[model samples]
Target: MTTTEHTPAPDAGIQTATGSHRKRLMVVLAIYATIIAAQIVGSLVTNSLALAAEAMHMAVDASGILIALIATILATRAASAKRSYGLMRAEIVAVLINCLLLFTLGGFILFEAVDRWFNPSDVAGGGVIVFAVVGLAGAATSLVILSRGAKESLNVKAAFLEVMSDGIGAAAIIVSGILNVTLGWNRGDALAAAAIGVIILPRAFLLLKQAINLIMQGVPAGIDLEEVRESIVDTEGVDEVHSLHVWGLTSGVSVMSAHIVPSAAATDAGEHPRILDELTMIMRERFGIEHCTFQFEEASHLGHEGLMHRDLAGLTSAPSVSGGQHVGHSH
Candidate 1:
């Protein structure tokens, strides 16, 4: 069955949080953009692989914040009939793209680091030190700006964590440069780059997994399917539930739909409305699910051949029964 849904406006319940995110993200974006340009030139001048890799990472961060900023602005748009949910998912999409890109970049940096370990390159220590310090300052400032709203939503958290890691990465580059200057250890640059990759790969993979799950309409984190089903089954009037579905639309939003068979006694007593209220209240309080839809039906509807969503519809309807035997594939 096509699930019935009621979508709130794009900015519904999020304006205050995302409003602050917009201003902070723009400031952070500008800082990262400037750092990318400066660090790229510095990396070329010093021929430091670590510095170069950090610059590329910062470039990706800049792009992430840029996308985040756009998403924040789009999130403010009013919900229209054509775009009922508005563009709140824009933030989710932006974070998804950023994570995939980060994963790819981590692989590239690791490969280069290993190659450099075999055949070392000349790294100008003094130049690397100066640039790394400058980058660290910028990354630190940006981190402070983003950290304030890091817990507000997924988008804000991604931006905050990215900048925080970059700040550490910048410090590593500085350490590598010092080792290169004092001991002629060019290998430190490659080691530093590899370390950066190690830092990035795990975080990137975690974020990628989360984004793909959301895109595939999986259940939200921290929600248990069995528990939800039990709550509904325990309700006074509901005898059975089928076609139950739960999924997250984006951050801070959960949706659910189900088909329920009412108890014969409850039907005779006209307690359907009370049962619905109890079920709804349980879902809201126990599971924190505010949006739900349920279809109430009699047990006799179970074998209705033309019923949608009960099974796939085609020239042949679902196998009902045969003689005294059940005629269907056993799951």
Candidate 2:
């Protein structure tokens, strides 16, 4: 695999994104601490399953927050020989881990809900309500912090979405507590827990899928391969483009590489620089790709009429070596 460096946007300013992320992380840590304390107290006093479940969920939230904080710190580190990418993808990995944690918690809750269905347990309604209200406040704080930073970075955005989803879960628990208190509906508690799990499931899956795709070097979601090819081909000194690939190292940071055939009329050495400039601009403006590599070659030097022919006959064809055929090309 090849690596390409990015030139930060001029208007992006200096370290503003990192500063905003740090602020959000501080807020999240405070909120998580408060909620965990409240939930632990509520769980002890009421001995309610709902309160205990919320406490456990809060623990997961705390862990996720810590992970995000660490990721942010690592991401800001200057590049070194040991890790040249500067730990930018650490945030993406953190998001993936958070999603996995949520899914695991959801599964555990679902299993408990299934068992409770057969053998229901009594829950303290008043305590459940009180703690849930407190939890909602924490969730709301998290939402505000996350929303503020979501536009700044993809990792931060992912963390924000996770917190937002947790907030929704808190809201559901609150409603369940209310129903249990007023109507004496014990099953309402389990139902609410299950509902929380349900809400988290889709978001977890979505985040996990995105993280995996990034890890696999799949094309960034917003870029269209066909559109990229078309744009390159339309460039003034380019006859055609092929074997183009685009992917993200992390969100908002995309890299691309392609093979280009220089137009027949543009053979002068002076024209290569102009071609490169046009190709780079096209990639940035049309495809939101800032990092790119173009391998330029004259069409005649390609030793075939087109990319398809070169792939099928010129490159892949068997060649006599000694007295036998060499069947494949080695890098």
Candidate 3:
């Protein structure tokens, strides 16, 4: 029914897909939870808006990493009829939720910080610096743990970046604490909070855009669709390629489908199988795209049925100039 280079064993496939990835998330969860808990207590004791904002940031990040862990665990489950991709998109969904949470809280913190700037509050400078130092140490340790796996997935990257920002927040609080002690500038705490918000909002929206693109089936980053099309078209025994679609199931896995019209002159018996093998190998080894579907067909079906590619715009396709074939369609 289908062709593949090799089928991995079930358990090994599961491990390769998500076992180690889940472990990566698991390894960082307790560390983040500890940081969140510590920051919450520190904020309460010091009455520092900057430290409070950092605590809120860590809370959102801890929840996001938990969701990523859950997604990876679900991904380890075998694929089924209803859930064909086996919950890989769950990581993207977690990323979407994470971004939304960050944006909402970041805005709230920004507003609060601005208000505090007009009417500064007295903060305990000694407690603020002590808490900031502890938070910095925690954030640094988390970063060290996550550095190896940060590039593994979008979900992991979001979590890792959140910690990185928290580290910056801690540094900001430390500076504010010093200013409060030496210069008697109580508004320094509010300034630190605003700085944290400014740093957070942009990164959150960027991750939000990436999540939307992946959900819309747009091509993943660092990949060129035209490059993929040209590679397939230039392959031996292939003619015109059409309806080529490329997207990711998750950050690390890409899937594609295309209709390949084979050259008639080279259409000997059992020839397409070899061509299919070559195509499969090309996608796997060349493009790092292992999950691909290529339908081999004759050129007569070029402008007919689903093989003509999809018309995404709300307009009828014009007839081809060569054959005057009408390409009217709707979705």
Winner by TM-score? 3
**For model 3, how does the per-residue alpha-carbon lDDT over 118-203 read when each residue is reduced to its tens digit?**
99989998889988898899889888877767676777778788889989988999999999999889999999999899889988
Off by over 4 Å in 2: 1-6, 11-20, 151-154, 300-331
Candidate 2 structure quality by residue, lDDT tens digits, 1-331: 1223354555653232434477777778788788888888986886555666667776776787788778777777777899977787787888788888889987888777767656777778877888888888888878887786777566666667767766776777778778878988788778777776676678778878888888998888778877787888777877766557788877667888876767657756557778787888778888777778887754334453354745632355423332122122211
For every model shown, what is its TM-score relative to the native structure? Answer: 0.77, 0.81, 0.88
Which pairs of residues clash in candidate 2, taking residues 3 or more apart in a chain or in different chains?
none
By summed lDDT, the worst window of 10 consecutive residues in model 1 runs over 322-331
Residue 173 of model 3 has an lDDT of: 93
Candidate 1 lDDT over 236-281, as tens digits, reads 7777776678887665567788777777888889887787778777
- RMSD values, in order shown: 5.1, 5.8, 4.2
TM-score of 1: 0.77
Per-residue error for 193 in candidate 3, Å, reads 1.1
